[model samples]
Target: MTRTLVDPHSVPAELRPYLQELVHRTHSVCGPHLVSVIAVGSVALGDYRHGRSDTDVTVVVDGALPGRALPGLATALAHPALPCPAAGLELVVYDEDFAARPSGAAGYLLDLNSGPSLPGKVSLDPAQSSAFWYVIDRSVAHQAGRVLYGSPAREVIAEPARADVLAALRASVREHSTGAGHLADNRVLNGCRSVQFCRTGRWQAKRRAAQAVAASEERFRPLVNAALRSYERPSRTAAAALPTADVRAFLAWVAERVDETAV
Candidate 1:
């Protein structure tokens, strides 16, 4: 049986109030520093898992942000009153590095359309193409997160439908499973299979993989393990490589823990 997990509210007493405060703090300090604020992830979707989720917020400055604001920003996040005590925060200062990327922000780029005046903006166009799609593809591929804060993330970008998710997955699979004798990266491969494909070519592949996932979890586990392990390796070239031994061993350990509570 799948183990029961605690509800998010039960796990974090101050989370809601903290987030509210964050909205205020951001608007204030960011007046000069930020032209826009975009909230992303499950939090924005309103389906955040208490202990499992971290806040994914994008603060877009007028120009590039100076180094001075980092501390103030950190304080706003780690303020003792909030839920979960700011375990971590991803502050993506969108500038040239972001602008040059193929798949901007992440793989599943949820653009925010918060409306005029507060016409919030954080562009994901920078990431519409490259390896970054792997991240975006996975988020939307899962259940739709609740809209905890901010407007609809889907409206800002040119998603054109669900084609973006399919495209990202296709790119991910090709990168991880390319070439003969190459060990296919399983974790990512599984993700590619998990998401629905909007395009005709990818739709067929998605269907085939979906059938395979349903038929055999055991067969898929190894691939998942391999990809998860190798996902963080330093990229030397474009080749699909296996993960380090430490990664493999760590995954094995996790498997043991999961099996321990098996129904």
Candidate 2:
């Protein structure tokens, strides 16, 4: 049976109209081939911090999207054409085959990373060389994503294997562990979430997972709480840095622990 697409009522009120246009524009591009559009990441997870979380989504098509439709679709949803209200908008489009049975390669028909401040990016490859993250995203979407259009998410998004997810989690820490632009709070909170996911096999909001880490691992409470505060209400200006050494140590510890887990 062919499923109908609708703007999800459960999303944040501000996003309702924006998403309506998103779905409408997407359908116009893909025509009847559009399958589903699943909302994922912080916005879908209910931990969306205004000015922090990006409006992330996955668009699925029955078959491959026509190459000619790419430019128009990308241009329409990107920055100036369709301004994003959140920190930015991150959207990926995949055909039904890959959406139903994902791989670690991170192939996509279209990948858009548009933000208000950050430069816009349109990619067809794993531009950052982190294909595994897309695989992990599919897992998160399958488990916790909300349906914004077309079929129910689970009906299209197949969960990636546990081993693949854990592997990706381990790889993910490297970028955040030590980099010029890596934020202190983001590193700490991300580390906590990685640890929590390893132990529970669940996808949790960064703050919730940080709280759990603090409650159980008292050693990291101070760091976790600090990060939580920053994440909940991010500052417009710079704040005191969380010790880089400490954040790196925690992430390394998380990677080791994740590697040890039975996937």
Candidate 3:
């Protein structure tokens, strides 16, 4: 059996009202079909910065959710209506069976990306898979996701293969290198995260991973520091932009380390 989150205080003080509203509205819309609500990413990881990190939530519903529940849930949780307190809300809905068992591929009923600056994507099709990021996020959720409203994550979430997860991390580094993904904070910090995962097979906090890289990898310290400093800021201004060449080289270095250390 898996353990649920033991301490209510584990969830930070400042975000409680938003979380309360989240749970209330979610229960209102999802009703009995909703099985679990797990908080992944920064909130679960204990390094959330209100203005910087989004409310990352994964909802599990009983398998075979009715058609009506989809849009109802979307509207209920979409920003402005629910009023996300963080940078935004990264929310995904999965059925109980899908979330509770191990699988080789990625799937979801809905991926609602909403915020003031977000894409406002209400992804409903299981056919459209963003496996690179999705798989990695799911893997992290399995290991670190804290229970908000359901069984413990260890009982409800499946464990993905280490190799598959690392492959996605490598793909992410490559994607940024090619300019397909270009957020400076994500690119630089994700590079640190990728290398850290390859070494430990654990998705620790990005800032912590960057700090680890800085301490051990002398050659990359300055670049890693720049990434860390930029990541801590409230917003990404032009001054926060990391050197393109250094970013590329750091990602290249991360790729090589991933190849070497991946289990």
**Judged by TM-score, which candidate is best?**
2
The most accurate candidate by lDDT is: 2
- Backbone clash pairs for candidate 2 read none
Q: With candidate 2 superimposed using the best TM-score fit, by how many Å does residue 204's alpha carbon deviate from the native?
A: 0.6
lDDT, model 3, position 13: 76
Query: What does candidate 3's lDDT look like per residue over 156-240, in tens digits?
Result: 7787777777778778888878755367767877888888888787888888988998999999899889878877788533227
Assess every candidate by TM-score: 0.41, 0.92, 0.92
- Which residue runs of candidate 3 sit more than 4 Å off their true CA positions? 1-7, 237-239
Q: Tally clashing residue pairs in candidate 2.
A: 0
lDDT for position 18 in model 1: 54
In angstroms, what RMSD does candidate 1 have relative to the true structure? 13.6
Q: What is the C-alpha lDDT of each candidate?
A: 0.39, 0.79, 0.78
Which candidate would rank higher by TM-score, 2 or 3? 2
Candidate with better lDDT, 1 vs 3? 3
Q: Candidate 2, TM-score vs. the true structure?
A: 0.92
For residues 20-106, write the lDDT of model 2, one tens digit per residue.
788888877888788888889886678877667778899888765677787778988997688787778889888789888856668
| RMSD score of candidate 3 (Å) | 2.9
